[model samples]
Target chain A: MTSSTTLRQESVRETRAPVEVRGLHRAYGARQVIRGLDLRVQAGEFLCLLGPSGCGKTTLLRTLAGLDAADAGEVDVPTQVAIVFQEPRLLPWKRVDFNVRFGVAGTRGARAQALAALEEVGLADHADAWPGTLSGGQAQRVALARALVREPHLLLLDEPFAALDALTRIRMQALVRELVDRHRPATVLVTHDVEEAILLGDRVLVMAEGRIVRDSDTTGITRDAADAVALDVLRRDLLRELGVGG
Target chain B: MPFLLLLAWQLLASGGAIDERLFSSPAHTAHALWMLTTNGTLASNVLVSLRRSAIGLLLGVSTAVALATVSGLWRLGEELVDSTIQMVRTVPVFALTSVFVVWFGLGELSKELLIAMACFFPVYLNVHGGIRNVDRRLVEMAVAMGKGRRQIIRHVVLPGAMPQTLVGLRYSLSISVLALVVAETLNTTSGLGYLMANAQQYLDTDVIFACVVVYCLMGITADLVVRVLEWRTLAWRTGVGNR
Candidate 1:
């Protein structure tokens, strides 16, 4: 699995790359959602996209996931991609373990892999539980486990933890960070939470009116004592850019 | 509750206010049921009736599923099948009995075809609606996870639509048994419906009551079968009464 991952990354970088959107444009009949956007995410990069409602971050993510066609320009992503939506989006009839194995191909050692993924999300004990029985936080964790189990070259998350309680949201953000770090997929998380962006991303891109307006490096901005003020300043600047408190 | 109804029926019969020709008492009905069972013809007739219903139901359910899947998946297929089916379904099923008899003769074919027609629409409508109602976000999620078209249908769409499909099947099961009654009564020489029809001619209230009991048992059995299937297949439903 590790070898294939590196090999795919090498081939991807040699040609179209894992996730490279350049001069992208998308429109919904009368209204445009993305316009000539250019962004490149390296393999193993955790990039958080932050924007107000209607800023096209979700549209960009959907385009990358291949759920929608790009009206123009390039969206070069690996064909094997996984997505975790705002809802768990589970097949309710299936058990919890099967839901976590949603993107996986077959049952050859799949149960163990699904269990391992569930273990990563701290829900291994609930692997047999139904999705309907899960709390929102647990369901979102299963969604995360599902996205990671396929060893996807790219993982797209669209506000996956936004519906959870505040404490659950914090724990989920940390869980996502850990999973992304361990699995090392090219991750793109779209969320409106500025602090979540700072806490979880290697870099943060602020989008507005279908274009990226702020590209801030969030690496070492949270844990490093020296960068405490820098982190605070970046947070305030992002909030200001988003028309939040000055 | 059933025992109380039986006791009330016994009391009514003993009171002698109601005529026996109109209805048989519980003891009389039970005695007639025993006689029919001991005579050895009732078992074969019940088997024949059940077989016809099962075959007709199978054929109907298979066709309904195929057409429903086609219409549910593609816009062109829907345009071709959905509206046409909707129009045909509105025509009362029994109204086609004469036309079916003229076309296929009074053999088992006509009866089975009629039963199939009767069973078809309910299953088709419910399964089609179920497929169309499968969560759009779930399909989106599956597509985003890189599942191909066949994989999406097999793994996602089919299971997602199964609850509604089962409801359709449950309804069809009931109609199948009762359709057997209609079909058997029309031109059959055997089966419980034949016995009932023959008893109607002679005013054999006890025998008619026995046949009615068999029909009720068949209906109840069909329902219990569906309940068992639902229990096994739909264990995931949280609020389901059974599990």
Candidate 2:
């Protein structure tokens, strides 16, 4: 038992700086979005960020995803990083499989890999369908497939399930948890839902005004072995940090 | 409904409710068309006109694409080129026929130039707008996925701007035909315009009616050609008017 525990810790330990961000400062013209922020995620860790709207969680995520350059920061991440925005953002002109195949490594087996990714997302049947034809949830599933197709070392999810309905949102949450475990990418999911943060993240960080206000270690209470009391305490803490009534 | 219109016209013509000297009967117009065809007048005139229209369309589309690329992609080009085009495009190009004749003389060159100028605005304006209005989200998505500059251009920018560019092509097509009529009126010796001109000199109402039919068919053919191109190129589009 001790040996197995050691092995598991080693597996999730920091390998080679999958996502190491420090002093990330971002500003949109005159208004500052993300102040000097520091963050890190381990090799197989899932980190959820909880914050109020316009609290710079997305700005931090975009900086880490390399979509926007950090004004002043130390951002060390692997080149194979995949990010899903709040919207599906699929190319309306391309089919589902082509969207998955986009920018995946190795052109030789890209088609087969795209198919496998789509199958994992339960969208294999929509390979040839246009992005415009799919329902909202289905289009987002295709987006998830596109993110996983790269087999990335760092995965960033910026409220990917926020647009979904209640049922679809819960379903996607489970699927994402399972896929993140399997792929084992250092993941950071920025979301407003406190329940989602506690359910999926091994560690949760609450942000306010472009900096982390509370960081909670939730490794002791994963979804599978979730203690109701512990989960409630963490949820209350996050909600309070986000300036909402617990 | 079109068949009924022709039937009504034929009834009015035979009953003398419509003057045959003014409005030629459909049967007489068809007979005149047959005479023009059999005598090779229609064939020769149509070939000359087809050559002119093709050249003008090609030149106009090429020039518009070149200008649109420059103006659409660069702020500097937009300031320099787009403003000048905006200034020039509003002057009703048909009214420029006399100016064109004086500049290039009443020759094939002037007719083709006028048609080319008429076609320039629709393609230029629409394609420039298309390039400007390409979904910024897609470009950001591509960049987030680590796609480089060339790949973003190839995958996102070009294909994203295509639907509106094709719309520009359709506008250019209809305008080209309209410009051809105005252009061919400038003193050239060959084309449907020339046929109508000769018929008008002798009051050949049947032949003039035949020429009108030919122009209508050409307009329909232009629209059909654009429809077919859109069907092939924009096969992924599945909204209103697609079916």
Candidate 3:
């Protein structure tokens, strides 16, 4: 029994990449969105995708999350995927707690887990409050709690903090980093912010026109005195690649 | 305001400011109402009208809801049902009473059909519009969370559409009353319209006024019931005004 259990675990580890895409192609009518994009994300890796608007960053994320079908591609993504969009997307008619457990089944277990997730986000007191009463940041926290309660294998964030104020955005960024580290789900964050990519990513890949242009390893430069200078240089390079002045 | 209006009306009628043949004093109308109720005339007519309107509203509103759900949730249902409803809705439903009388012989069937037709449009339009207007982002979120199609409709679609659906319900309630008034005019030996018509010959303005007051009260009561339903089902909708 022990041998079979070990074998099953080993087989799982050997076979499944959290996310994989090869020669992906997607189009909207005559215009192409993703053009032969190829990439892989390992389990527990945090990859940040930095690109200009309309450069297929969101499209790629949606495709991987299975919210949109790819026109043609070899894509292998875990079925257990959760996404956080720029909008909170909480159902207005639902209470905050129910929204957190939006799609989870087994009512009793889901409610318990949802409350725990709300507690993690410091919103346990708002369990019965209507979503309409929540402030933007509070609503977004509920959204994050909703995603987290799923215990997803792949977490996709599409500019989840883009609508927030600077202070709230920073706080949310820290929360996301903390969650990602603690839970260690393979994460893909799509952002237009070069600084955000630098701060939160294990690997940052710059994309232009649906294909990756610059891929870098920034695993060593997070909050270390020895790598501060390297981080700055990388930031400058990334900004230039994104067609923004550093 | 209504009480003040009634007071002014009573003063005008009692003081002989308007012709007695046309206008009756509120006290006289009240007396007529008392007499009619004691004799069971008002009770029987009100019961008849109420029963007809209730059945018509139930049938019409349920059909509207079912069709709207099918059309709103599926492209095929929309294609098959929506265009036809839109075209039919453009025709004044009350104007079909003549054709209905000819076909159904001025019976209860024609009156009920007329009332149902009147109730159908507003409910159907509001429900369809509400369902269609549900935020696509929320639906996408549900899909991302791995909810099935039926589950999406249950959790996201229905609740999201509820406010608009209730608005439609309120509109249909008023429309149903209006239709019931018109429908009661067809081959009626029964209902408030019959009492009013009988009073018209004798120039018994007090009875006519009493019937009018009863109709007004019925309309107001239906509106109040719908308002209470909105309040109960939509408690979570407090922070934002109805969208």
Top DockQ hit: 3
- Candidates sorted on TM-score, descending: 3, 2, 1
lDDT score, candidate 1, position B171:
95
lDDT of 3 by residue, B1-243 (tens): 989998998898888897877888889999999999999999999999998888889889999999999899899999999999999999998789999999888778888888888999889999999999998988988988888888899989998899999999998888878888899876799998888889988999999999999999989999999999999889887556632
Chain A alone, TM-score per model: 0.90, 0.89, 0.91
Candidate 2 error regions (>4 Å)? A1-16, A105-109, A223-226, B239-243
Q: Against the native chain B, what TM-score does each candidate's chain B reach?
A: 0.95, 0.95, 0.95
| Cα lDDT of model 1 by residue, B109-180, tens digit | 988888888889889988899999999998888887667888889878998899899999999999998788
Stretches of candidate 1 off by over 4 Å are A1-18, B238-243
Error of 1 at B96 (Å): 2.2
True contacts kept of 1: 0.71
lDDT of 2: 0.85
* DockQ head-to-head 1 vs 2, winner: 1
Kindly list the per-residue Cα lDDT of model 2 for residues A106-171, writing each as its tens digit.
444689999999999999998998888888899899999999998888889999999999999999
Clashing pairs in 2: none
Angstrom error at residue B184, model 3:
1.2
Docking class of 1: medium
Clashes of each: 0, 0, 0
**Over all chains combined, what TM-score does candidate 3 have?**
0.94
Q: What is the descending DockQ order?
A: 3, 1, 2
**Tens digit of lDDT per residue, candidate 1, span A198-231?**
8888899999999999998888776574787898
